[model samples]
Target: MKASIALQILPLSHSADRLQVIEKVIAYLQKQPVNQVVTPFETVLEGEWEELMLILKTAIELAGSEADNIFANVKINYGQILSIEEKIEKYHS
Candidate 1:
């Protein structure tokens, strides 16, 4: 993997179960090989750029299917030799 992507998906559901939809997406992401961090506003994933793109597509589709509307906020950091662990390891004891 040569790149990392942080994807924050917000599903606008007419129903009150919006969090449920987000949780479903998180569960799906958890199954992938990408290193992932779930935060209050986004989920950061690190892995191959191509693989991450594919996963993004799947995540969007899954969220769309589960909600009436969806918004995805994506941030990518690339072109350097790094990994998710490298970026956050220092913060961990």
Candidate 2:
């Protein structure tokens, strides 16, 4: 894969709205071509570099629209990275 990113979107909104915003972002992320691994606190995506960036941008903005503000924690690995499948294969049941 050309890139992989771990994106955590923290939306600063009331409890009622915060979860909906996060779910919205996750739903959008799931539909993309990128391989997505959604954990309790973050979503990891593996795909081509440009594709990943564009998806990340749209997801952040999607959450931002509903929340007062957002705090995003992103960890990016570009070039010669392990595919999401390779990384998690051993852990799968």
The model with the greatest TM-score is 2
Q: What lDDT is obtained when candidate 1 is compared to the true structure?
A: 0.85
Q: How far is 63's C-alpha from truth in model 2 (Å)?
A: 0.6
Give the alpha carbon lDDT tens digit for every residue of 1-93 in model 1.
Answer: 477788888887776378888899999999999788888888888878899899999999999999889888899887674776787789995
Candidate 2 structure quality by residue, lDDT tens digits, 1-93: 499999999987664388888899999999998788999999999889999999989998888887878888999999999988898889996
In angstroms, the error of model 1 at 4 is 0.7
Give me the overall lDDT of model 2.
Answer: 0.90
All-Cα superposition RMSD per candidate: 1.6, 1.6
**Candidate 2: residue 67 Cα off by (Å):** 0.7
Q: List the residue pairs that clash in candidate 2.
A: none
